[model samples]
Target: MPHVPERRPESLGQAAYRQLQEAIETGALKPGDRVSVNALADQLAISRTPVREAIAWLETDGLIVHQPYLGRVIAELDHQMVNELYALRFVLEPAAVGMAAKNATDAEIDVLREMIAFERSVLDDPIERERHNRRFHNALYRTAHNRYVISTLSALQTPMILLGPATASDPKRLLDAYAEHTELVERIAAHDAEGARAVMMRHLTGGQRARVSYLLNQQRS
Candidate 1:
């Protein structure tokens, strides 16, 4: 299991939830791994009640399933889950990017540029690379300045959070993704809402096809 640091938590339950979520996200808790409340409570240094609460929440998020007699199991990675993820992304991400193109301020655009500019320093660390990518996307969505959009997406378990590690683990795919982000940012900076939306649609469509195809073929294999 990953050593998930405690958050600046108000209650023990929230801290336990965040730590367990991080473990699942980083693949320290795998599909077949045992999820014992007693063991998790000891590991998190929290009481059983909080760990139980955390487990309940994760179960609702569909990350964990209670198997008959087998107890709690991490949900297996499958194409349907990945498709559901991309389906939501197609609906929300491009709309947010379109809004960002219309509404983003000079300062907000600069923030995105700086995020891209700082990428080279983190290229060696896979975890940092993933985080940087998330921050950039989060910043883009926030640039829309819509509270509802911000709140909804913030509450979501991102692609990495929903599934295990990234499907696009290839170095070349990572580079291509960075390029796609850059192009979308430039479109937004130009106040070309339609252009930005088109860029985002193309970006998501390519990823959806690739990931879905991989999973389907993997199942056959």
Candidate 2:
């Protein structure tokens, strides 16, 4: 039999970009970790060009900093950045949930219910519970039928992971969050746009409080 041609792997640059992005999102690349282009290329079995490109992309996204002679390092989270992120969420998520109430189909509501059930089942593991919580919120945003809202919310996911663990780690916080989600879903199901929006605002507010408290405690320590 004639030898078959092997399929080409993804471009080295694309692979490098994806791997680096995941590392940044999952906290594997912590703040201030130096970005060694040569070492990254060697480790990922790629070339210098791609690693450089990946670094450039991260720099543009403000996830990494480029310093003269010092090279690039993962960017640190600051108070202002955290405030701005939650502020943006406060403006956007309520609107998305309100719109979802008006436009979401019966099938979408069913999907939301399933998401809630999944979240409830994962309450013992904070990380897994948070992941499911994020999924539920993302699904609500998607159901809003607004492309920009969905895009903006999706971009916030990496920053969320960087906030250091879930507020749902506390049993009380987790239960309260679940109740808020349940109320929001009920409002959506009933086509109560204003009610859903109010619930969403409260949800985001509670989350912001938890995250801010965590950051403040970290500073104190």
Candidate 3:
């Protein structure tokens, strides 16, 4: 008989980490939801060790909290945390847009234009619109060509997802966001770093206000 290769062991820890992160981002595991290691292990068809490790990872990322008696729970967003997030975004995103304007290739700009077109087409579908919005931001970050900036912005996305409801929910706000995106793309294509930066900063500021307002309304109701 021919010898068979041994099966590679699965990295349950990594898999569990990804699963938990996705759940949190998609609102399935909402803020303050209890984390159950054994239930997660069963759900994921993995071991408790991995589930524990995954919880630790999320905790370190500020996505979840582990209490001595209360167990692990999804991290809830307070007004202060929201403000801090927007402040970080305000500082970093403009710098990223500026870098992108200076460094992005013609091919990259074309990709961004395509993303904008896709976003326009999906305006009626909130889910699809949100996906395109993310794509647009990811493309812009990629254009910056800075690994650190790209990674940091990528990490920031999970928290943004906690804001709930797509930013495209408001037609007027959606139109405004698209217009700003279009302007940013054009400036980048024109290699106007300062213009791109200014437009991006304004865009983020507007978006932050819209998101905060929406969250506040939800709390009120």
Candidate 3 regions exceeding 4 Å error are 1-10, 67-69, 166-168
Writing each residue's lDDT as its tens digit, candidate 3 over 39-68 gives 989988888998999999988888888766
Tens digits of per-residue lDDT, candidate 2, 107-175, equal 999989888888788888766676677788889989999999999997876567555444455677778
Give the winner by TM-score: 1 or 2. 1
Ranking by lDDT: 3, 2, 1
Q: Which should have the higher lDDT, number 1 or number 2?
A: 2
In order, what lDDT does every prediction score? 0.79, 0.82, 0.84
**Which numbered prediction scores highest in lDDT against the true structure?**
3
Displacement of residue 77 (Cα, Å) in model 1 is 3.5
Q: What is candidate 2's TM-score against the reference?
A: 0.82
Look at candidate 3 and tell me the lDDT of residue 86.
82
lDDT of 1 by residue, 1-221 (tens): 99999776378888888898888877788766779999999988889999999999888877778888899987776788777777788889889998999999999999898888787566656566766767777888899999888876655545345445555566766677778888998999999999999999988887777677767776798
Clashes of 1: 0
